[model samples]
Target: MREITTVGVIGLGTMGAGIVEVFAKAGLSVVGVDGTPELAERGRGFLEASTGRAVAKGRLSEEDQAAVLGRVTWSHRLTDLAGADLVVEAVPERMEIKRDIFTTLDGIVREDAILASNTSSLSLTEIAAATAQPQRVIGMHFFNPAPVLALVEVITTLLTDDEVTGAVRELAVRLGKKPVVVGDRAGFVANALLITYLARAIRMYETGHVSREDIDAAGKVGIGLPMGPLTLADLIGLDVVKEVCDVLYAATHEPSAAPPALLQQLVTVGRLGRKTGQGFYAYEKPGSGVVTDAPEAVGRPGAASSVAVVGTGDLATDLVDRLTAAGTTVTAVDDPGADTASLAGTPVVVLVGGPEGSCEDCGSGDCLIAEGVDPSDATACECCHGTAPEAWFGAVAESLDSRTVLVPTDEPSAWALLGRIDPEVQVVPVAVHRPTRSGSLVEVARQIDGDDGAVRSVDATFAAAGFVTLVTRDRAGLVVDALLYPHLNDAVRMLDSGYAGAADIDTAMTAGCGYPQGPFAMIDEIGADEVADGLTDMQTETGDPALSPSPLLVEHAVANRSFLG
Candidate 1:
């Protein structure tokens, strides 16, 4: 609750020095500590070089840089933190080391002084429990390159006081970083979700479902992430990522947090990251630019071709848009009525319909067909027979007979279609259910083709404006739909459990965690039937109870009476 003018930063490795530089640049006098004088001086020098780079880049004035640099005093003694109001521990992640540091600090700092940890992994509660003043302990998790990445996770232990929590939140904002408050669970919000997602990505890569390059490409292009997960792992230092995963897995007992074997082996081989000149990608010696081939010496698979989408709808449309923008191709489909087509002939199809309609039911102009009624808008179909899709799939199969069919529908339709399709046919189900952003479908197709003309192009439609694509082949949910469904369910669970509200959860995700939109809002944007279809597909695929459609979602879909509307 006290105003912070003087702060202490414990440990001055890369993150620590960055933290120190960040605080001092904000005009706070910082006491930066290390285990020894040599280490303390080294940490100071690291901060100087970083600020010097800023000065050279004209990002900071010389006078301001010097003043900022002047504010940090290096120390080898723990007691040097005695006069500071806030102490942020950026120590190595070993629990013994952190426990020792906190126990020592408990005797040195004032009772009202806030003791915070920059631990991205490890339990905030456990760290706090090590000290006599557990109420004063909290988490101020700064992202890597702490001076640059703008998000901070403000974590609280069960024993942490409300005033301390509020103070840390205010401090984060004052530092020009967006902060989201979370309980002291392992990995907090960002890492918990992010690491698990990244782990899944690795598993996907290992399983050969997608290549490393395409996996990264998928997150960057498919999920709207700034960088691919593998590239991020390299930059963060694979060893560090492993350590974080180990801590998280140990604490949460969540199997999802367990580090992949490939990640650990890379670290053990001394291929840490940019620091070691190699990782998922090799780096330029003495610099951070990545080299893609070093890991092939250890059996890394070469990249996969970025997925090439063939049509324009909610799914293929965006595929055309993203692929073209990414410089791939967008093939146009001339006629859905044309028979004798193979998936090799079409490769993919975007089946556009409302919830009540089937591919057979939808009108010739890409509209929904419900019973005997033909509707132009396919966005709001609410009919759910659980057997209608089978009837429709059979109709579609009979219509296209003997030729391979690639059906990209929402989860329910996909599941129904999957059951009806003959196993011998070549059917590839893709999940691409996110909306289109500002750009041309012509451009998105170019990106998908990626300069491989020999890669064969067939019928492709590039619908412009207000036409978005959802691309998932034969699953309960396609890529975007499946990704969003679990999170929406999690959001409902979070609100129902009193962890956060709709607005706060939305704010936390959009502002604090970098999601494009909050879960509930996205569901509304996507439509209830579409979401239900996705969940239905997922549950069918995994037979997992967790993937089942929520009663709330079903209610909304029924009341709306249309997914396309």
Candidate 2:
């Protein structure tokens, strides 16, 4: 393949200008084009503002910034790109406009010159087929603010030549970007997984299974995302999100890719997210990230001076540590045989049960009896059947009064335990999820009877302990696990279909979409067997095929292997 020294970038919008800056920063001669002179000048302003910020931040010297700008030759004409070896069009996402540009550029650039598009959605194959030298056309999809983000999805159509893709891939490396080669698939790597996940989060909220606040909190605190999916949708513009979802759904016919009615309605109402100042959330104004209506709008939590924790393992141990560290007097019980007499006087009683945090065999901790198992044939896994959770819960409940708030940690059916106790002791659903860099989160399930004293006390207690708290409804998976596991399954399905390699998918999510960890890394960190089991259990509950574990995930989980390996 010929060397790519001079490059051409068409379209001078935010994305287009960023692409121009990327090439110019790499010391390549660039012909940055636009449809008109005004847009071209505005494009220059984009370059100036970006580099100016870098200089202001001391990350770039004024001389270097000037040199980077000096390498670009601005133009409004297609003829100027004739001398360029690679010309990437960052025009609007309209198919007709892109096809016209390619058809025009087909005669302008040389036969061997690579013609690439920076489309986030739209078919690269159709665009390539519009040109005379189809083999030389490819997709060079760069994430927004292209100069900053490290990922560049290098997409290849069946018509694209191997040399063309290779040259583009090498060029991406030289440009200081990580390129993940993929077939002509909608949303490609980063977006395919990302949009699907976002859509699911929206659906979850729309279904009222979880509130919007809880959904976002679940992603942020529960899964350690930088921002929640709804927050991201607002920033990305709901219109764009809907548009991409439409394309993905059309391409794959997957239900998860279908845009939720809430998302579509928001777009129709002109609440196109932060751009309009109203999407899933109301922003301070147009084009602002500051939310006007914050989720944690509630007043200070009701205080709990002393709490009693019952049961054993990591769940109870962690709770005890956090509560003690917060200065709340915690009466601890490590052994199963420990007395429950102390649980009677405390303001709250936190029940952290057996080997699985609750009952071992029972699903969702909803009942002492595992679903589908006969009462007579219950498993001997002491937690569910024998002298385990049933014993501790009965003991603790027998001692506690109506005044004491009981929180069954990670249990969905904490309310059901009301029968086990004599008094109407408010049972709150509390799930202490795994801790992240941000800190641990205690998920509180909203009580159906409007009993919030338990919620506030649990919130206050966990908050004082320096841990975040999110209140979701009493549903399966609470908020985090329900939304997260399915998205990982989607990534696995992508890998299973050979659309992209494991490393590339991970790279795309981590580098392109600003994820803390890739899906595969999450599966490994969360445990493959754990994720697969979560998906399987969720599938049985919701009957969503998308939530069902992929055969690959099951294979890996059964073998105790990581997807990265």
Candidate 3:
């Protein structure tokens, strides 16, 4: 492995400047190069501002910050980088520009010097092809605000020398980064899965399936993400997101990788997210973090006229409290006296118990049976009797006159099954994983018979119950789980394939993307077997190979061992 002492960073943009700061702060001599002296000076200014903020936050002493800044030499000439042991190109996404710089550096730098690109989506092979020493070229991708973020994806092409990749990976670790090595592929690992998930969110917004706030809230509360996908895209800049999506789509030809038309339209109009003060949601000003609802944004749901709460459990109790707070006329019937007739006049009925137990007829003639419970089984009446699909369908069928029947459960399959029971029945499956205060609800639409009004109304009713309603089509995994399971499966596969260790991958996601938990920790909390089963079911339903459960996940699940263990 080659020793890395001095580093050269090309292009002095936001990413480039950050990369310069990272290397300098790591106690390395850094040369910041740009196309023009003005750009080089601007890059210096960014570094100064960034370090100044650190000083203000008491993270770095003024003397230490000065020492870090003093180590970086800014210049416009490419020849200044000739003495560097490694040159990381952080130029724009344009291929011509990146290749041109590589071609120049190929002649200027020493033959043994490693060349790397900090591209999020571009092909490493194509970029390496520009130089005569393709074997010496690899990818050293650093997340945005490189000094603050700890992830560094060390990507290697087929032609890239193993030693060069290893050297870069080791150097990244030495620079206080968590490095993960992957093949030279579009979007690498993080963006490959991330772009697909973002595109799905964008599609949901474009089709008016849900509001922006709900979409973001689902990510935050449902999966414990630090920010919603749309919000993150805005902070990242919509144009940049679109560019990465385009690159991934072109490379894989996957529908999920393609940017939605709405995103393009927003970009075309110069509404490039927080950078331009407008995207999915409007920001207070350009580059501002304070977000206000868009002008035509749909307001939160108002109080419902009447809603009936049936069954018992924590979910029921939470629902009752939220409904009452929303000023809805809550008709709670926890006793055996309350029956089908008790819920007859209520437009919305929230059933909390599983299939089995029967309640006295609320005057509707038939017993009020919980869905998915077996009424024939004498033990089914127990409060803990699991939810039975047949019982739920039967209950909903008896209450056919009710405007909406809300089934609160975390099982996506239950939602899919209930939605299939009767296409005409307004069966809205709700997944409330987080507490009511988190304001996250996964609302699955089992069937949309062109009646957008009815669907929106049901969504509003639930929203009024203090749940942030994330609407999605009737599918096995719905939105959050559908996207999340597959991504985690991929992470497991990466671990299994030795692309990266479990700890490194976890550190990369948590540090790089601000995720509350890495994939392994998530699987542990949700149960590895449960996650594997969810992914298997989704794959079986959608026939998407991407959703196929990983063998590693299956083995760990069967053995009951943690991924870390």
Estimate the Cα RMSD of every predicted model relative to the unseen true structure: 7.8, 3.3, 6.0
Candidate 2: which stretches are off by over 4 Å?
A: 295-297, 354-394, 411-420, 447-450
Q: lDDT tens digits, residues 226-267, model 3?
A: 788899889888999999999988987967678899999999
Going through the candidates in the order shown, the clash numbers are: 64, 0, 16
Cα lDDT tens digits for candidate 2, 1-565? 6699999999998899999999998999999999888888889999999999999999999999999999998888999999999999998778999999999997888877889999888999999889888899899999987988999999999988898889999999999999999999898888888898999899888887666877887888888887889999888888889989998999999998999999998899899998888998898999888988886655556768898887777777888888898788988876657777767768988887645545545433435654564433433333445554654566667788888988887443353353466657787767788887667778887868847777888778777887778777776677888889988988899899988888888999989988888999999888888888888878887777777899999999889898887
lDDT scores in order: 0.63, 0.83, 0.76
Clashes of 1: 64
Best-fitting candidate, scored by TM-score: 2
Q: On residues 1-565, what C-alpha lDDT tens digit does candidate 1 reach at each position?
A: 6698899999999999999988998888999999999999999899989999999999999999889988999999989999999999998888898988999998999988999999987888888999998999999988767888777788898899999999889888888887888887766666655666666566556655445665565555555556667877777777878887887788767555689988878888998877788877766773566574733422212111233232224544444454456443345442333332343433334443333334333322123223443322222324532324334444444434333334443444443343345554434333332433322211121123222221112112222222222221233343434445665655554555555556655665565445676666766776677677667867888887766776766877779653223
Candidate 1, residue 20: the lDDT equals: 96
TM-score, predicted candidate 3 vs. hidden true structure: 0.78
Ranking by TM-score: 2, 3, 1
